[model samples]
Target chain A: MTITITAFSKSPDQGMGLARDTRVRWALEEAGLPYEVRLVSFRAMKQRAHLGMQPFGQIPTYQEGDLVLFETGAIILHIAEHHAGLLPNDAHARARAITWMFAAVNTVEPPILELVTARIFEGDKPWSKERLPLVHDRIRNRLRQLSTRLGDADWLDGSFSAGDLMMVHVLLRLRLSGLLDEFPNLAAYVARGEARPAYQRAFADQWAINKPAAKAR
Target chain B: MTITITAFSKSPDQGMGLARDTRVRWALEEAGLPYEVRLVSFRAMKQRAHLGMQPFGQIPTYQEGDLVLFETGAIILHIAEHHAGLLPNDAHARARAITWMFAAVNTVEPPILELVTARIFEGDKPWSKERLPLVHDRIRNRLRQLSTRLGDADWLDGSFSAGDLMMVHVLLRLRLSGLLDEFPNLAAYVARGEARPAYQRAFADQWAINKPAAKAR
Candidate 1:
């Protein structure tokens, strides 16, 4: 069955590959799956059609035959479960990897998201400047723990799995904030994830779509 | 294998069951699995021993034999995968159910968490009163989308699965905020979740541990 995933028609990231479709695309590449993309405009995403597929009406909904899945973590896990490379064969190892996937999103990403809201949505607010450090410190606390756990390790656990994929992408959002640089090991880890052939392919695919030149085409 | 999980020695919620451990306990109850709980103090949670089991230094870590896992989503998923009640047999339905789990934590809970931070952590800040409405609106936006999707349905998807388990727990956090009351359907949905036998057992279990009388005893 051909897999179809939705992405922002013109991503807010403007080809930076920070949009979540990059995460799903990267998972598909890692799993060696061929998938098609259906772009949805910001307006259409809130409409009935897109809302039916994604309850949150967010970009990056997955469809394959009769199966439809949203949530990047779920999409990646579904792809990983069906494919060989993205998850470990050992049941315990696989469970541990999945734990990391949850940790990445639930524990780590929430603080990073607050930083985004601070900078982007509430930038002009009276508290924005004073509150910025508090948000950054919250992120740093998480990164400090993560960096300590990741010391000298190549990936989160043994080999690169969906956990690493999710963690690396979550850490990517911290790049512009310079918080990632404070943790050298995490920065290196993100670089290693970026160095992956699958990630490279995924990045290029979204870049092609969102690039200024491609818009003219 | 006997399953052992951890929770806060004295929860901040006092007996209300808003903690993530309640979610895991609810899943175990739904699965008809008996488990043991080990309570850890706030200081202990940040110590090396606890951090070894949970890198993020949070509670609700599951240990079954050599397979140890943290993150409530992953733990509940592990239990649901092993048991019958928490998930559907259909592969597609199962994937969609897991999608709701991720949606609960990633999409919906983040804003609610921000509300918690705003009220508890930053309540003394000068901008708390002014910025709260913005945070509340963000949550309302997500709930509005969720309420629209739910309509008259009892659950997010068909049958009560881990998705509903998670979404209900996530929404439970909103009760004190009064934001949940705005969405009558969602409030009823959460009440429906609380009314379940499994959920009732889970709540009573935590209440036994954290209740003021029990603490005095």
Candidate 2:
């Protein structure tokens, strides 16, 4: 069956591969699967057709024949479930890996999203600058716990499963804030994920589509 | 195997049944599974022992024999995967149900979490009152999308899968904010979830534990 995934027609982060689609692409790459990218314009994303497929009007929606899925966590988990590269064979280990996926989105990413809101949406507000430290503190608390859990381990659990893919992607968002540097192991862990061949290909592919736009600006 | 899950020794909402454990209990009740609770003190939550099972030191962690799990989404998904009542048997439908589970947390809950942070952590700040509308609007956007999707349907997709369980629990957080009332259909949908026999049991079970503490306060 042919696989097609939606992505931003116009890159939000220039060509940095910070968009959610890049992680989905990385997962597909890790699974050694070839898929087509369906670029969706921001306007089109909110239109009826897209919303029918993804109620959230977000990018990185997966469509394999008649089956459709959204939510990067779910999409990644789907890929991992079908592919050998992303999850453990053992039942308990697989469950633990899935736990990390939930933790990455629900536990860790919320604070980072708050940080984003503080910087972008509330940036012009008088309290934005002053209140940012509070948001940072919250993000730091999660990073501290995650770093402590990770330690010097190569991955969160073992063998770089989807859990690591998700946690690494979640932590990657913090690089712009520079809080990741505070935790050396976490930073290194992110670096290791970036160094993966699949991630490299995913980055390069998105970069190819976004480079001209970045240069033009 | 006797399933044991962790909960807060002291109820944060004073027996309002807002604790994460209530949702876990709801899942267990729906699955017709009896489980024991291991209450963890706030101070103990941070200690290495508790942190070992739950890296982020959060509540409603699941332990069944040697299998230990954290992240309520993960725990609930695990229960659903193993039990008959929580998930659809068809593969694609099952994936769709899981999609709602992720959407409930990753999409809908993030803004609610921000609202919590704004109210609790930043409430004393001068901007708190003024800034709440922005947070509320973010939540409203999500609710609008979700309400549109839910329409007149009693559940998100069909037949009260784990997706509905999670979405119901997530939306339940907004009842105090009164935003849920704004979307009449969504409010009714949440009420339907609470009206479930299993949900009633879960709420009662958590209430049983927290009632004494509430009276003491």
Candidate 3:
């Protein structure tokens, strides 16, 4: 059975690959798995059937044969587990790689999300200006700690795995904030991830989808 | 080798079971794993050695023999993978369960964390009050989607697994915001999770460490 996934019809990011589907797409491309994309409008997303695939009614749901999965982290993980390249063969290294995947989403992404909230959704608020600095500081604080640990290392653990894939996606959100540039090492680290062929393929694929619409606008 | 975990010396939650360590403790209790808790002061967490164990320098890093892992999602996953009960025996089902776990952390928790950032960190911001409603709406929107899908379903999947444990914990953060009350089903759902004997045991065990100080306050 063909694997099918859903993504935003017109991503708010203008196909910069910030969408969660980009991660899933990147994983699929890395695994050399040919899949189909099902673009969904924001309206259709809240529908009953769509909500069944995603309880939170978010995009990038994976469906293969009888199995259906939601969440980019989960979808990428499933691909990584079934495919060879996304994880390590060594037992300990595999466990550590999985740990970094969780860190990327759980620990690092939270503050970045706050920055987004401050910028887009809360931009009109009176305290948006004052609160923006605090959100930035929180992100910087996390980045400083992470930079210190990642010092002089290419990846969070030995060899890149799904962990780095997720981490790069998380850090890419900070690109607009300029917080990533503060740590030269971290900035270079993210650059390395973006430069990956898999990431490039994913970026181009999504960008192709939105390019026409952006031009029309 | 025994596993060493880190936790707050005195939880600021004051035994309310809001601490991240409680999640690790709950998972450990459920796994029937014997572990040691190393109380960490906020100052010590920023140190080099401790940061080595946890890149983000947060509590609840798992150290068993030579293996070290951080991120509650990763630690819980490591525990669930090593043990039996936290995952399903069926390969596909297990993968889906893992996906829900990621969704809990990556999707659901982001908005709740936004509420926290707004009220606690950005409370002093001039636009804090105006931004609060937007944050609440974002959370409510996610909750509504979740509630609609969860309609009468006891769990996100077949049986209670680490996914539910993570999801329940993520939803628990909304209790203080009163947003949970907007969705009666989700509020009840969280209660169901809290009612679990394993969850109770985990709560009590961690609460014991902070009970005296809670009394003092």
- The candidates, ranked best first by lDDT, are 1, 2, 3
B85-130, model 2: which lDDT tens digit per residue? 9999999999999999999999999999999888889999989989
lDDT tens readout by residue for model 2, A1-217: 9999999998878888888999899999999999999999999999999999999888989999999999999999888888889999999999999999999999999999998888889999988888989999999999999999999999998888999998898888888889999999999999999999999999999999877543454
True contacts kept of each: 0.91, 0.93, 0.91
Q: Who wins the lDDT comparison?
A: 1
lDDT of the candidates, in the order given: 0.94, 0.93, 0.86
Model 1: share of true interface contacts reproduced:
0.91
Give lDDT tens digits, candidate 1, residues A104-181.
999999999999888889999989999999899999999999999999999988999999999999999989999999
What is the TM-score of candidate 2? Answer: 0.98
lDDT by residue for model 3 (B1-217), tens: 8988999888877788888988888788778888898999888887878887887767988889888888899889889988977999999999988987998898889888888877787688666676678888888888987787677888878898999899899899888888899888888889988998888998988888877643454
User: After superposing candidate 3, which stretches have Cα over 4 Å from the reference?
Assistant: A212-217, B214-217
Best model number under DockQ: 2
Candidate 1: where are CA atoms >4 Å away?
A213-217, B213-217
Choose 1 or 2, whichever is better by DockQ: 2
Place model 1 in a CAPRI quality band. high
> Candidate 3's residue-wise lDDT over A35-54, tens digit each?
99999999998887897788
Q: Model 3 misses residue A196 by how many Å?
A: 1.6
